[model samples]
Target chain A: MPERVARRTWPVHAVLVVGALVMVAPLVWEFLTSVKSFGESVRVPPTILPGTWDWSNYTKVFHSIPFGEQLLNTVLMTAGRTAGQLLLCSMAAYAFARLAFPGRDVIFMLFLSVLMVPSQLFLIPQYQIMQELGWLNSLQALIVPGVFSAFGTFLLRQFFLSLPKDLEEAAGLDGANPLRIYWHIMLPLARPGLVALGILTVLWSWNDLMWPLVVNNDPEQMTLSAGLATLKGEHFTDYPVLMAGSLLATLPVIVVFIVMQRRVLEGIAFTGSKG
Target chain B: MSNRWWKVLAAATVVVSAAACGGGGSGSDGGPVTLTYAIWDKDQQPAMEKIAQEYTKAHPNVTVKVQLTANKEYWTKLQTAVTGGSAPDVFWMNGPRIGLYAAQGVLQPLDEQISAAGADTAAYPKSLVDLYTFEGKKYGLPKDYDTIGLWYNKTLFDAAGVKHPDATWTWDDLKAAAAKLTDPAKGQYGIAAPADSQANYYNTIFQAGGTVISDDGKKSGFGDPATIEGLKFWVDLIKAGSSPTVQQMSDTEPTQLFSSGKVAMYYGGSWEANGFAKNADLTGKVDVAPLPKGKKQAVVIHGLANVAYAKSKNPEEAADFAVFASGKQAQRIQAEAGAVISAYQGTQDTWVKAHPQFNLQAFIDQVPNSVPLPRSKNTSAWTKHAEDLLLKAWTGEKDVADAAKELAKAVDEELGKEK
Candidate 1:
């Protein structure tokens, strides 16, 4: 068995290394292209690396609009969405897991149905809701519609339900209220799930284009992704600068992913087996 | 790590709550004078800002705030905002949605405003000015007008030994030349037969003397023999290796094909002239030709109009700005900069001078033969259905005759619902 495991390990490592390189190709190209001068990037047959590095693309991003403020806006929006979703999803999950409620299955199923519907169908009605709330062209317009996600609720619910009830029963006997039990015992236990959810939320919210582009037309409130689109006019192609802007926009997420790599992996591993 | 997460979470909550509480900053003006001016292009933001400043210069109390959004998103957002009573006071109106938005009463009737402003309606092209007129009331001022023309790469034509496109050229002459020039194996194409309607087929359809929509705008013209013939030219061109596949062409707009020197000639819009003029490789190597003849010479005429949003708190200020924006001074600023083909007569020469090379005058001449884009109550919703069905036809998913019949039925259904 040990010899078979040894024999399999080499191919697995080789496969993983190859898979890892494939995943990083776009990032590598984006970084290399970002460093290239606009003239070099558009050349025929395309250079693998820039002959001369130009940092002006990053500076141009700032010059084009109030990019710094927009960056701050995107960060705030992503963070707001992540925290709100984690708290709301976990709380709802705990309720469905521990507490008995009337028509709970029916309500949960209704929320799950939202996941199956095409997002485009909800766009018009969602825009109407934002306008009614007087949040059009505001940060709330970007953050609020996404705050309560059906996917997050459904996902976290499964995690909550699968947790051993004995652990919570012991906490309950210690005179912990349901809320206290949720905060101290349940949430810490669900840390890996919460981290996984948070990372996913940040990534989705940061890369989101359609809704933010629709809701926040005001330059002041526009997110990084939408703001990056205006870099090209109807003509006058500038591939290098566009690549640079894209890399800058993605930097924060890449940083977050790197920091939370362990927890995210553990969460994935746990979910794979349990699922 | 946990502390970091908590800190980030706390910081984010504070920012979102702060923004939510900002209360739109409540336009410093003490009175009820708030105006919203919607624009589809953020590229023109500076120009609009200047117009707003001039308006505010005269009327100290009126403040005009610019609301700019991308094209498709703007209309979708506008529909919802209008329904919810938060539509901008003054917005950019296009021919397609004018009737729908107006019929829904989401837009204020500009009949009084037009007469009040004493705007010279005669200075605008008759066909274009008439596009915004329904039931004898003007809904918008023609901000800028463009016509479809042939933009060609002189270097490619020279290499292919094809002569320049001229006023006397016919459709058959173009096909023979394009076919001879195209070499698909070499990644080269002769003409870009894009499936774009306004710039590509609309001219051909109009030239063939077939209207896209019926007289009452209640039926589809796709079943018309001339319309189907017009559609076939594009598909036939793709099959003959005279053009790229619809999928390949759609990946890159045809103008990019011309810029990359892969295509010899492009049937592009006059609006693209400014963008093309700025391309260094294309600067001296490009030129224009009049739309080749079919049954008669025809070109698609498109323009944007300044519209007033009904939900605006300050309608008067918004109207004043709209009128001023379409006035001679602003029009000349855009024309002289060669940014657009100004709608106002006599000021068009400045646009010609904006780009010294190429026959900009060709556009000016074709303006008389231009036909306005077809419109109904809800132009976009109806137009998009035809666009998608037609795209499928281009991709060989459906036969041309069958696709035309389907498009005709679908367009008829949408037009029927409009009634």
Candidate 2:
């Protein structure tokens, strides 16, 4: 039995190894190219290793733009969006899922309809609103618009609906109000859903390129993604510098994933299993 | 439940009112003025900042903040800002889109400001100045101009025992040298004839005495025999194994191929100087020559210009700064920094001298015979058609003439909608 199991698993392991290598190859290439000389970086039949590891490329990334400030902006923007979504989305989702409100279904459907429209459809109008609010080139511009997500509300609403009514009814008999029940009873039981939503929001906010690029222009005011974009040139780009900047910009996210990878996986799995 | 709905309505009302009342705090009277100067190239940001500092020094109360956006996103952001009525007070404008912006009343006309400052329009290249003029009114002041040249690797030339290209070299000379320089065993090509319009074919088309667009900007020149012949020059090189296949060129850009010494020659722009100068391997080995002559001596020239937003709060200040940023002093600073070839006529000498190793003067010398980059009110619409159909021809999937005819029809249709 053991021999048969080992024989069957070898092929599966081999295929998995190949798939993993394919996924990792580009990232490995990016790191290698970041340390290569400008000439070696673009060498035909491209070189796998650099003759000399140019450490200065990393330093050049810092000098070219305010990497430190942009990183901080990215962190703050992500945190703000995640916090705002968790509080606002949970409240709205609870009201939709449990409360007996007039036109409740219609309002919820109206909110869900936003998910059908493309994000780009809102760009012009949102930009105009941001301009009117004098928020262009501000950190608030990056955080505020991203905070309210209809998808988050929808996800949490489904999670809330799945919860047993006995806990809420017991809390109600104990003289707990809807807000108190949501905060103390329902939210604790809905931990997996909240974690899933929070993780998704963080990832989306972290990697968002177009919105940040459009909203902010100053290097100091920009997020890491937008700041890294400035390294590209119109006609010619220095691939080494760009790669180095990108590696540095994505390092924090990679580190976060490494530390909280199990939670991220569980959250993703929870969503997938439910779907 | 009703209370919750009322709370949501109240929050919505607050957001809407805030948006409606939130005025962008710019262009106030008498206090210190901070003007945003939006640019695309981070490579030239230092020189731009220096120019801004100088402007602020002269006008102490006015502060110019230089905002750098990447080239790919710059236009999209600009379009959004313009439509939203909140564009930067002053921003960089390119040739092809100037007409569109001016027609849409997004860019303020610079004619009155130019006259008031006594700025010599003749100081800049005539082609550039004419390129920015829309409906007989100038809307932009030329900042920096770039022209194409034949950049070659001297080590490869020496290895192949081929003589170096010079000013007097002709089309046949280039072809012969390409044939000699190509080495299939080494996986090296003599040249990279990518289907890039600006660096490769457009100059050749003009040199062959064909115009990309009619003077009236109402017709496409791709259908013309001379234009097809010019395009075929690259195609023939590809066929002869002297240039990379279209697929190869696309996979790895021609610029990368040339920089890595995989290709011996590249028809590139003046903007490549900074990138090449920074590369350690190609430092002494690379130099540029005037593009080899075809039926005539011609190269394509284009430049950026500084234009004020039409709805800027401080219109006068924005217009003045726009003109100042493109004036002789700023151009000199830009040239000395080796950022670009200044559009001002007399400032190019400094730019040529900035890079002594390469013969950068070949670009300046071609100014007399240089044709302005072909543009219309909607250049991108037609340019997109050219790219798609020309790719088919370059890939050998379709005949060049057939592709050119289809491209011409599409371009003509786009142009016909311009007015």
Candidate 3:
């Protein structure tokens, strides 16, 4: 019986291993390329291993732009957006899921409608709003627009709807106000939902490229993604330096994901299983 | 719930009102003036700042801020800023979009300023100056120019026992050299014949005595037999096993392939000299000659120009800065920095001297016989269609004649829309 089970699982393990390798290849290539000299990076039948692990590419990335400031901006932008989305989206989702009012369904539908339109359609209008606020080249311009996302509210709303209502009713009998119940009861129950939304928002905000580039021009005001973009020239690009910057920019996010891997997976699975 | 909604509305209203009132901080007065100059190249940003500082030094009250966006997204950002009515006071403009921007009335005309300053427009190449003019109004001052040349690998030529390319080499000499240099065992190709219009086909089209766009810019010239022959020049090389297949060139760009020593020859632009000079591997191995003669001796000339915004608050200062940035002294600064080949006449000597290893004069020598890069009121509208259709011919999936005719028809339709 053990032999049969092992035989049955070997193919699954093989497939899983192949899938993991496919996903990891580009990242491995990026690291290898980042450490290679410019000449070796572009050589045909590209060398699998570098002749010399040149670390100047990292120094070049710093010299080309204000790397430390941009990294700080990216962290601030990510943290602000994540925190804002969690609080606002949870509150709105709770109200939509539990409270009844005039045009409640209509407003909920209106919120969901925003998800249908492409994000690019908002670029020009958002730029105009930022210009009016004199927020161009500012951190608020990157954070504020991203704080309120429709997808986040919708996902949390489903989680709220899936929760049992008996606990809320018992709290009501104890004279707990709606906001009080949300804070003391629903908020703790919705921990997994909030974690999921926070993770997604963090990923999106960290990698957001276009809006930041369009609104901000000052090097010190820029984020890592936008700052790294300046390294790319029209006709020629130094791939080694670009790869080095990208690897540096993405390393933090990778570390964060690894640290929160179990929580992220559990949160996603909880949402999927329930709703 | 209702209270929450009201609170959100109140907060939004406060934010909007605050923004509206605070947006007027940059109002023009008899105070220190700041002019924002937008550009796309990070490598050239330092030289641009130096130029800006020169202008600022002359006018103590004025300060210039240099803004950079990468080339890939520069247009999108500029368009968004333009729509928001907050574009940079002065910015770089290129050939393809010059007509589109000028026609839309976004570009401030520089003719009056040029005449008022008695600036000799003759100081820059006439073709480049003509390029930035729309409806007989000059919208920008010529900044720099590039012409195509035959860049070859010296080590490959010596190894293959072939003479190096020079002024007298013609189409036959190039073909013979390409065949001699190619060695299949080493996975080496003689030349990179990618369907790059600026570097590869445009020069050949003109050399074959065929125009891409007519003198009046009303039609496509792909239907002409001479143009087809010009295209066949590269296709024959690929078919003869002397050049990389289109698929291979696409995987690794022709420029990169040549730089990596996989290809022996590349028809690259003068702008490539800086990059080639910087690459450690290609050092002492690469040099350039004037493009091999086809039906006639010709190359394609193209450049960028600096233009002022039409809605600039300080229009006079903006125009003055634009002209000053394109002056001979500023061009000299750009040349000495090795940023680009300055468009100003006689300043190119500095650029040529900046890189003495390669024969950059090969680029300058073709200036008199150069044809302006083909552009119309909306060049990209047709160029996009041309690229897609020409890929069929490049891959040998379709015959060159059939592809060109299809391309000509598509380009004509796009050009027709410009009317």
Candidate 4:
């Protein structure tokens, strides 16, 4: 049995290695291009390696925009969205899952209906709401609309429904309120679900381009994704500078993934099974 | 739960009312007014900032804050901002979009402001002036103009023992030079004739004595025999092995091919002057000349314009600043910075002198015969169809005449909707 398993592992490892290379090649090429000169970068049948190591491309990114401020804005936006979604979605999910209420199923259906509609349909109305609130070009404009996601509520509701009901009933018999049961019993048990949601939110917010570009116009107020976009010119873009900016912007995300990859993978696997 | 919901609703109403009240009472007279001027090109930001500073120096109470967005996202953000009633006080407008915006009444007409300031519109190119006029009202002030030219590789010409492109070159002369300059074994082409409308075919179409859209703006002119002849110019180059295949050109853009020294000549715009000058490989090897003539000496002229938003809080100030930014002094400042070819006539002399290696005057000389870029209320709608149909002709998948006729029918249908 051990020999048969060992024979099967070789082909699987071969396929996995090929898949890993295919995914990693573009990032490697981007790094290589970032170090190349403008002439070398655009050469037909492109050269694989830089002729000279030019570190100035990194410095040029800083000169082009306020990279430090953009990094801070991206971090803050992600944190705010993640925290707001976790608290709000969990509470709404608990209400729909445990507490008995009139029209509970209908309210849950209304929340799920939002997930059915495309996000593009919401852009104009959301812009008007932000304009009315006088939040255009502000960090709150980037954070507030993104905080209340119907998808997150749906995901957490599925998670809450899967938990055993015996503990909740025992807590009720002890005279504990629904909110207390939710905070003490349900949330601790839903750690894997919360982590999965948190990871997904971080990935989405970190890579989001359209909403940040639409809401914020000021360089100082823009997130990294929006700031990096300004490096592209109308007629012709300097590819080296753009690639360099993209590398710096993605470094933090890559670092976090590498450090906590096991937890992220487990969370994803757990969500996949439960879902 | 019911009480909490009510409390939340009340809080939201109070917040909304407070915001509404706070936004209404600002931008009154005698108070400091900051007018936002939005632009797209990061390369030209310093020059724009300098213009803003000069305007602010003259008007102490009025400050112009410049905002920069990437070109790809500029129109998208502008559309959203306009719909949300938060567009910039003044923003950059282009010829293709001016008709749509002006027709929609989002752009402020500058006729009254021009007369009040006594600014001379004739100082700018007449074609550019006509471009921004809608229903006999001027909606934009021409900021900078760009005309197409033949940018040649001097090194390639020298190596091939061919004389450089000159003011007197014709269609046959360009073809002959291209054949001599091409060396396929080295993976080199003489020129890169991609399916780029503004830089390539549009100029040739006019040079061949054809129009894209009629003066009435109600019909398509792509079916004209002369326009087909104009398009055939590039196709013939590819057939003669002097230019890359359309697929190859699409894979590696003509700009990249030209900049990397793989192409001997390219039909490019005057706006590329700054970019080519900064390129390490192109700086010494490149120069410009008049676009080789066909049946007529014609080039397509397009430009940027500064237009005030009709819904701007400070409409008067925004219109005045828009005029001031495109005036002779500001244009000269822009020219001196090599940001663009200023639209103000005679100020181009400084621009010509800014970079002496290239014959920049070739672009200015074409202005006399320059045709305004063909546009209508719905230019993008027809132009997108034109691009699709032209690509088929360019790739040789369809006959040029057949493609041209099909494109004309589609464009006519789109134009019919505008009425």
How does each model score on TM-score? 0.89, 0.95, 0.94, 0.94
- Report the lDDT of model 3 for residue A118: 98
Q: What TM-score applies to chain A of candidate 4?
A: 0.96
Where model 4 places Cα greater than 4 Å from the true spot, the runs are: A1-7, A271-275, B1-25
- Give the alpha carbon lDDT tens digit for every residue of B118-142 in model 4: 9999898988999988899999999
Docking class of 2: acceptable
- Model 4, residue A32: distance off in Å is 2.0
**Lowest-sum lDDT 10-residue window in model 2 chain B:** B15-24
State the TM-score for model 1: 0.89
Query: Per-residue CA lDDT of candidate 3, range B1-419, in tens?
Result: 44664565465445433432212234454567788899998778888999999998988777888988899999999999999988889999999999999999899999999998788998888999999988899999999999999999999999999999999999999999999989999988899998889999989998898878888888999989999999889899999999989889878888888988889999999988888877888889999999999889999999999999999888888898999899988899999877589999999999999999999999999999999999999999999988998889989999999999999998888888896
> Candidate 1: deviation at residue A103, Å?
4.8
* lDDT value for model 4: 0.88
The per-residue C-alpha lDDT of model 1 at residue A118 equals: 98
**C-alpha-based local distance difference test score of model 3:** 0.89
Distance from true position, residue B131, model 2, in Å?
Answer: 0.7
Model 1 / residue B378 / CA error / Å: 2.8
